[model samples]
Target: MKNKFQAILLSYFLLLFSGSACDTPEPGPPDAGLYHNYAELTQELARLQAQFPELAKVVSLGKTVESRDIWAIKISDNVTANEDESEILFVGGHHAREWIAVDVPLLLARNLLENYASDARTKNYIDNGEIWIIPLLNPDGHQYSVTTNRLWRKNRRNNGDGTFGVDLNRNYGYQWGGPGSSGSTFSETYRGTAPFSELETQLIRDFAIEHQVAAMISYHNYSQLVLFPWGFTNAPAPDQTLLSQLATTMADSIFAVHRVRYTPEQSSDLYLASGDATDWLYGETRVPAFTIELRPRSSSPGFILPDRDIQPTFQENLPAALFLIQWSQQGGTMTLRLK
Candidate 1:
């Protein structure tokens, strides 16, 4: 498995990242596949663990405001122990409406496990590296999106008034209360009363730090961008060159799969979103963090990325992830210093 993984690293590395422009996507309605609801996601994680006990391990980081378990699916060779293997963390569903974001990581987890034996590359990564997939980070918000509101963006944290949530992305400790972050309870981008005030954000923060994740990608949708940090500010990150290169490589890999173009950018390029997960992960853990805003950049409706797009989205992002895993194993993954 390791030999094949290395073989892929040498052979497909160039094709995946530095390939020629792919043709435009075919015109059609993206398949509205069965997007998983909160309950379904929990069950799916459990099923993966049950089926692949050696490679898959399910554990709850903590519970959300609504008391839903924030599950972590750890896929690695030594599932029970945290060995020397370099870890790459993938988190999705920060916003409930970005249903495609949720499925991407879930699909990634499923593919890695189901193909462990049959696929040599998958087997190599699973057997040698630690891949942590947290498919639904904001479960309460996801549930809210499904039942009450289709566009809920925050966790179900009831503010003192009538408002019901704080944007988890905007509530991280780094750059808290800065521009692009909100203080009003009713605001969709609310930064919360204080940083890491919500259990969900705090849980992720603590877990990522404890595990010392080498690289982290927080998934979102409707932008078709691969964003690197300094999300809180316009200043370049210390590891700008490497970060930019990796992000562009991933963007190129995604483009090659679906012929969909995704600009590799700094978060502030689109807008100022302070206290976001990417920035916090980098500042707090020195993990080379990225936020991949998935598919249908201009034409598709913002958050309502169709169900059919889920498979292709994952297909495109997987190669970049594989590249990152291999790079981390070689100890060149995260170069930025912790703040």
Candidate 2:
């Protein structure tokens, strides 16, 4: 009897422990394994260049706060030469936690390079246009988000007040410090002490000014939105009509792929976020700028999108990206007046 009771007790304890373990929540999303870290992204870019050396060149625009290279891949027929082709820029990972943003542009670059020889449209874009893709802009913040805190959203800048970061998106020079941004260092949308404060923002600004970037897309996430400039206010941009039409077309392209509708609207319609990159790119350079918020139209999956969704997300966004690239070739007709 005693032996049987001991055996029963052991089995009960084991069952209780197993049940408790199963009930415990996961420390992070199980799908976090699906995304690449900064090092992996660097390696992938290197591999792509090696595979398509004639058409792709990887260049480091500058380093991030953590000394990670802010790499940009230029894809064109004459990748090494500065040809007089309309340049289209695609930027991703503006906020560290937006992992899908990084993947979409990276995949877009890979797709274009891989399809150049076989696809006529892909070949045409590469032959006639310059496509610049910066897939990981905030590498430090991204690394931190991937390894330490999944929710981290800013660059790892020490604010000297024990606070750690500045929202890179809100660090641009145009209409900076306006509504929808915070001056407090602890705020998520904290604009830095001044415009173009972060090295990341400064490098991008300098690069855009140096290149004749005709059209630009900066990808963010969780909203499924295709946003245009004038994020600073509700007032219409000088090129509002043209911008709206283009935005609608891109949104339509995105919808056609997965039947997932992404709202086309002004950035201010979403919120009055000043110092954003798209606003600065349009306000200062007269470039046709857009902010594409990708995937998980709802907050359920939020930033931690699953591995299965990665390819599909890239697939849907690819058409929209190609449309923008093709649009750049058309001169991106801007109205060119002050906001």
Q: C-alpha displacement of 4 in model 2, angstroms?
A: 28
Q: What range of 10 consecutive residues in model 1 has the weakest lDDT sum?
A: 24-33
lDDT of 2 by residue, 241-304 (tens): 8899999999999999989999999999988899999999999877789999988888988887
lDDT of each: 0.85, 0.90
**Candidate that scores best on TM-score:** 2
Pairs clashing in candidate 2? Answer: none
Q: Name the top lDDT candidate.
A: 2
TM-scores, all models, native as reference: 0.88, 0.89
